[model samples]
Target: MIFMHIFSSLCVRTLTNRAHAIGDELAALFLLANVCLMVMPAAVRADETTGTARIELLHLWRTPGEQAALHVFRDALSDPSMAWFDTPVQGGATGVRKQLSDLLAAEAQPNIIQWIPSEELNQLFDLGVFRTVDTVDEDFADKLLPEIREVAETDGVLRVLPVGIHTYDFMAYNRQLFERLGIELPTSWESYLALGPLLAESGVPLLSVSDENWQLTAMYRTLMISEFSKEEVLSMARGEADLETYRNRFETTFEILFELRRFAAPDREDLRWEETVARVERGEALSILLGDYIVAAFDDPDKLICARSPQSSYIPWGFDSFVFTHVDDPVLLQGQTRFAKAASDIDNIVNYVMHKGGLPVISGVTPDQLDRCNADTLVAWQKRPLLWEGLLQGKNRIMAMNAVIVTIWRDETITPAQAAERVIDAMSRP
Candidate 1:
């Protein structure tokens, strides 16, 4: 099996890197494809009789921790007593998408493909191109977080094995500073606003925010989602909700943003995200509202404490998964099942979270040795309802509207009512 995996990888690399090496490269690939067809049938027959199989894994990542998690899985697959050989074909997000596209079109099919859930997830499932989790292992289906498991399903069938749930909307603050100043973390948007005058009097900002369009846009989007439930947000986005119905909420959300602006750092526009967080780290600011990446940024883990924004009811998150692709060979099918099960096991779960810095989706697999902020994040993940990322589309549209709304509202160029109208107008665009 190992020999077969090495040979197959060499064939793929050769085909990829040497496509233009000869004028008849296309003809050569056609011949090679024919050779593969001839060889696979014999190999499948051999594997069935010998009880051995080989599978390929297409792994995706954006961080070093994720890369480390991939290595953990690879090491598990390398167990000496195992009957199958697994090889990892690696790439970043864009490369993973290209690989999945090719595999879905049946141009190539690795045994496992890792990716985030997207709008096209159900379409792919409906085509019968991937295996459901029930087909993999019934016990495995029982191990995932309820919300994470729910989102992985299509028509009540599980289609993906989740790796981690990574939340993006969170606030990190200095616990010591807050304790010293005798202020509690805000429990709602109103409480957040009430902190403004106190923060101003202390010469510390209520929040450390950046003027980076995406940063502000992400903050606004969270506030928008929190101001309304996911269902309401989606309805308003689809133009199903009348402007008059949501106008008050939109106005309130904008008011929160404007009020925070008054207490923000004077040079916030010139500060990078790291610099903005540094203010909170140094106790120069009360808090910073951003993504979970801040959990890993603290030099002294105990110095930071994180919580979901006061307005957030369900934490909006992104996740990674190992999605199984369909294969007819029984040995290869069994190998794929084992791969999925191995990924969901407790040891891998903890290692992935500890190394990868994301919340593990399986229950009872707490990561060890986390600093205060990361521990808080893990607790929040377990306690809060999960809203998977990418549910909110039209980011460029949101960013554009937010830029106009923030600029005009801050400068008193538009009334909150008119700003609400502009928001609805932006949503209505094609």
Candidate 2:
């Protein structure tokens, strides 16, 4: 049966690139027969085996260090007591999406796969394709941070597990530049905005930003928090909040953004995250709003400095996690649970997050372990209420409004009020 399956798969592969010919119908019949004879029997046997559960993982980042950590994860699963089956596939962003589509179409979908922030997981949950871990293990829910749990839960059911938390829209500045200018670190939006004219006078560009819309989205989300509470932000996400409230805050934010735009470089729109970071590192730009993952770009710690965007104080920091999809086999479920626990173990979790230059969601790391982190950046992750206040109060919203207003200001498209109105318009969009 296995031989027939291999033979049929080969014929299918060959026919895949060929145009339909006279023998096409016969070839199709042969392929169909082989699939029934070979694939079905193997699937039945796999179900009967019962002891080992198979899982496939898809991940976005395929850096060398991440690949190494996956190797460790694979080795951990190989333990005799584990009763696990696992495969790891690494790909670029586009590849990950394609692979996910293929998995959803498989005859027997994997018991586990990587999940992103999208409607796809919700769709899968609605299809009953994923098992609810929250139902099976109450302890799992208890182990998560409240914010992490909140993000993982969809409609009162847990759909994913958070692995770590990172603030991608936080701002970073060159310590040397601030020192040279004799300017103190700006703590409030008022103080941050005040730098615009000073930068203009010095002929130094004050801000550098990327061209990516998602980065803009991250910046906007951070800004939204300044205008709304955590609950309000979630409400907005659920389509329950008033768009006008969000728009009003965005208007205030755009005014500041337009002012900052005067100090940006001429070719700023052509720059990307890496290029902006390079500018900051080279002292060409004084500050940038970037994700915490920027630590991954710099090899020498001395050349760079980082701080949480004053705006990030509005949201709790959290990371993406792997959630096991639902499976019918009880043994497989058990194995998956065990694997999840092992994955969350402090030793492994801390090492993994630290290596990636992000904060661990799980709480077991020692102070010494944290001290070993190469970068000396201040992480602005705080508890819930303050986080919400920062977001809803207009502090963070300015950052997003600033991104667009600044661009317009640079292009001479409109006055600050008009730029602010544009930001309000953008935020008001669905």
Candidate 3:
């Protein structure tokens, strides 16, 4: 009886040990499964990493010198820590509207593309296509020029990162011609008009305007700045003011544009901005009302002299910046944030723009970098107020300013007052 009792006890003990062992094995398997599920995707992404990025760039075929500025960006991305996974796929300049349409259609778009104006940015944001970069390093914003920093943001959100700072409404001159002709630089619209006949008499076109309507439009905005306060302009654009008020301003600016046209080259209707700049460079035209980017457009930097527009009190006419679309992809969003932060860094901004013969938007560039540029020209840009003068302002009235100028220049059928009326009509379009 005693032996039987001991055997029963041993059997019970064995069954308990077996049950505990099974539970241990099951727990181990569950933990392993959880880790595999959690970590596999990240491992896969890691393996797929190709150190080089494939980026598609869309920009106008400007001067070869301007095109070559991409090297500075490419080199900046070569740092190991930044780990850019892009390789540039260069494409010819398509119209801004067309490019946005195609970007929406592509299954996988380029990681980065040059941004269009602010109006287009609004449309892009509505589509939920762009990724917002929130993890930008604190120092990034500090590197940008105050104007660039202001323009880089929209509704308090930082959109595009500016690759360079540009002042679009400034004028360029042939120093030798101005000196030979013994003409002092014009200081105001009135002064400029005073010299127009003298310039025409010397057989040099007073201004070389491109047939491209945008250039003519830019001139109108510069003139508007002189005539109206910034608040008045913004209010008019937002439809807070009546057409009569806007028309009055528009007509005033148009009248000046018309008067300036008399001194423009006869073939101006056929000339593009590049050709116009080239004519000025060759001394066929005494001056051109263009932006600082003209310095990059010239093959020999020494041949050009850039200054704030003598006619507009030296206020800058336009600013270029980057905007991100509302993107949902975590990986892409991370990458863009990193890129934006690096690009906006003060040192990088200075390096990129200065190398391209552009002014640094960020302050504190070393003397060595500034030494490479035309010192006086850089100083002039530093003192100017950057303007955002493109059709991107989303004001129909403002856009018409360009159309009116182009139509008048081309057909020679409309008086300046009539052109101003047409501009008011266009701006009033729903």
Candidate 4:
């Protein structure tokens, strides 16, 4: 159960491929937030052909549903005025962020990015690499919830333009499969664990998950956000809550995370998030705890019993965005403005978010406009703050702490107490 071998081999491959760039280890040592999102003349892939404004994009949407929403922009840009080109970046946005250590070491910006709020991305924002949302529309602030607008305008700068609000902290499963298992739908993480024996008889794992760093972080954060009260989570992030104050809850939470191995697919180590959902769709597993963005993978959204986290009376939420990096070219600026204008338009963004199973960032979206899970969860989520991303408080210390959880999961010798101590230590570090 020493899964460090998997991480080690993966690191070796990355090191060999990157050849002389810093790996995750050295990047952690330096503690830079993200590789600077600076683009050299060659890095900025803009070409003007017959007055067509073209933009090269690095994004994370690949599913049919995801593609459907993406096509909204694609179709919008096809009118000879502007267009977007896929700049292939491996591992999507979250992957791009995880690989930033090497991205900086190699003086390259190729992979890993998650649109979550962070101190590192914030640094890049302060440096003015990304354009402001107001440039898209003078009155763009009128379209979003005041709080969402506030997050978009953190520090009074409107740099991040969120297209859709979403949450990956939910667990969704096939209702028929749950009924066939002859057990009631488990309402919370504790209930789910209590039913483990019954679920085992059905010859399927109870959950499906991805094993990579960012995905694992999402999984861990989902549980942490769900188990603790919003106020507690906020306080912990603010360094107001000490370990002794919440030691029992912290240990119990980590224990539940450690126990997840009993219910997860055995070979999910290298599976894409989509592949994990595929297993659930085919009934190879009973359910998957993932973001609502993957709703396209299911054959029927109505048949799925989806809820925010295995626990969480209140939904944990976040968003997906199209962040624009500044380029001085008029055509590229026009293209970026056109893309943002299209992304936040009521009619346009609705279609995009619906295809991806998320709520539109534009105001006036009613439940009737959404799918079952989203419609059912929307009201409660309205009152909650953004999930783990909002809780980031600008520290990448979550990376080091997540390593402790992974160790606890992959090695039984590391007790939850030990993991909790390691987490407390990570939180205390500079």
Candidate 5:
């Protein structure tokens, strides 16, 4: 089973990377594709003797907490007539998308997959990647949260199975560290900066962040969200902002992002989000500003202290979901329907949220100890803005923006004003 995943991803990457090169590379790619992962069929029949279907999965879940939550999901859908196999992809949605494309190009079909549910998700169904309705439980669509129920919905039919939900902007800290230093949560940018000297004297860092684009952007974007109203942020994202608006919006947050450098954990430019979470859990840093999903990463609940970022008044939410490739086999289709029903079951979702760290889509879910911070805050947080980070479907130059953000932290010459200028320049490009 382990050997099945190896050839497909590597073979696809090798062929794709060289396709743009001239002459010899083109010839090599043509020859290589013949012997590569195309030979690994996406769908395989069940063992005749056992009559158990093999449900292979391609997903982006790898962290300790996500893995644990995935196990719980598998258990809920487990059946004697089926078995689960994993083909984990390290490169997140982009990687999974690329590999899935290569497999499909080769006419191989990997049916079950993890996808970020958004408006664009319907594109998959439109492209003949999968279909809904008949594949899901009759009541599955009605069971989802209204916001989730509408995502990836084409016409009156939903195209994807909503799995887990979360907001990435929330901050979680070490309670013991804050108490030891007598530090209070910052209500505004000024207050956050005022704590600098206190944190400096105590020789503890203020927060942890990573250079990974999404991780850095979530932190950067949240700070932006704190500065702007929800309507303004959504408006800017929609490209309604004029030149001065971009300048004002970006510069204000970049200034705070620049100041935040003095408080960030040292030498964390290379850290992954999970590693940063561990830093806070170890009390090595005072806090970590990341998605609330990281709650399960901490072994002890006593060490966790949760808060929204400075002036964060909105609760931005998004759902993680699974979408299937069309399958004609009755047995496979039955398995898909079973999995969909299990995933949307209110009780199953509540239990899954225990390890997954977000609210169930339906109501009446009481906040367990870890979820109290995110769940309890929803009442007072007021505006429930659609989450902004992953929802952007390349609307702006993300790589260009990410490069400027990295330089803003590592190179002081790239001043906040200049970062604002460059960020606008990035945003302006096609």
Candidate 6:
């Protein structure tokens, strides 16, 4: 009952952890709820709809290209000739979780919700909050990128359709600015750290990042994966590994975090990710550590140079996906199928890549037509591994670790050794 209460309150806007750490207690509670729900199958209704079926899709993305791409799905799902049903796309970032929680509580709810095929979401799937789309169309499965196909499915049931593959932890720099400064991009972590003071001396911010929790989490995760081997990161995520077991790796990771703070833009605490990228675009900053979505902000490929995060063999990536609801209404079920078809359409997938500046998940949607930087990112994507497997699968471990790193970054009093202990302590809590 307490788990249900927490689940019911998750979508409460006032309680959402937008700017701070997602509390360890709340995350643990959800983990318990997820474990209990695993034994029960999600309920599906077979009730026939007596009237027109209308469904709402809730999403957090907001960009001109994303809006346009979403409109394409809107039109396709609304076509009268399709005999299934009409659907509407609703956009919002604030209060989206609250909205989803409320919607899922209804007997007749929206047909689909935006989903990312990650460990956290898979827990929701296990709780029966979403329905499988594996049988919707066999062809859709064939179109998914090989790297993400297996992750999209749970226990042989596919619950989401991936729209695009994204690299959340990569470095993007200003080519023109770097050329003028006569400094080559660093290829190793040590070399990269060495640039901090040099860039500071030149009055150029070496990197731009946001103060936002999720962004901080992404940065922390990037460093963790880079400093530790994949096996170590995965083992830590599984609770089998601890800071004491790999103190050197953990301390080194936090030391890198603090060193970068030395050259970070002064206004980083107040700037949103878009504004931070703008610092690089305007040549006020030499480079930025952010998501591939930053590419969408650039007008020309040559203006920006993308690279695998320095000293890292694998890049942390994410993908856009949608989860279906199991409503009994025939019309709504038909609408769900129609929406999936539109999402899987090659033309739509291509349009998404052109507009959103990421690698389309569907096969055959090549990046040949994209600008040089974007095309290069796609090519480089093949060399990196998605961070979804093992401990990186869920948001809790990474977020908890990031919360500690963020504190250490703001307080000079905290040493890397102490930060390492804090992260292990936070994550080890029951």
lDDT of each: 0.65, 0.55, 0.58, 0.64, 0.68, 0.66
Better-scoring candidate (lDDT), 2 or 4: 4
Candidate 6 or 3, higher lDDT: 6
- Candidate 6 wrong stretches, greater than 4 Å: 1-55, 75-95, 105-108, 120-123, 134-136, 154-157, 299-302, 328-331, 364-370, 389-399
- How many steric clashes between backbone atoms does each model show? 1, 21, 17, 9, 0, 4
Model 2: what TM-score? 0.65
The window of 10 residues in a row where model 1 has the poorest summed lDDT is: 40-49
Which TM-score value belongs to model 6? Answer: 0.79
Query: What is residue 361's positional error in candidate 1, in angstroms?
Result: 2.0
**lDDT by residue for model 2 (1-430), tens:** 6887676566444433331232223333323333433333222324444355544455755544445545555565675545444444543333454454444333344666655443344544554545655533456566666756655776666677656556554666777888888887777667876887787787778887654554544554555455556666655544566656655565665555555555665576645555666787788878886666555554443555565555444543435567675455665566667667566565666666655566666543444565332223222343334332222222333334444633554456676456556765655554
TM-score of 1: 0.65
**For candidate 6, what is the lDDT?**
0.66
Q: Write the per-residue lDDT of candidate 1 for residues 154-268, one digit (tens) a residue.
A: 6767788887767877888787778888988788878877887887887877788877655676677777757888777656545576657877888878777777777777676
Candidate 5 colliding pairs, count: 0
lDDT of 5 by residue, 1-430 (tens): 5675677667666666654343222234434655663354544544422534545578887887788877776887667777677677866676676666555445454667888765455544555556674555667677666777767456777677776777766888788988887777778878977876788778888877777766777688778777777676656566776646668768788888887877888888668778988989888788887777777677765688777777775666677778887766665666676677677777777777777776666644444432566565444333455553445554455445665676666777687788888888876776
Q: After superposing candidate 4, which stretches have Cα over 4 Å from the reference?
A: 1-47, 97-115, 119-122, 154-157, 383-388, 393-397
**What would the TM-scores of all predictions be?**
0.65, 0.65, 0.73, 0.81, 0.84, 0.79
Write the residue-wise lDDT of candidate 4 on 189-292 in tens digits: 88887766667876778778777665676688777765677777667766677757777777887888777876777887767777887788787888787677
Clash pairs, candidate 5, are none
**Sliding window of 10 residues with minimal summed lDDT for model 3:** 35-44
List CA RMSD, all candidates. 8.8, 9.1, 16.9, 7.9, 5.9, 6.2
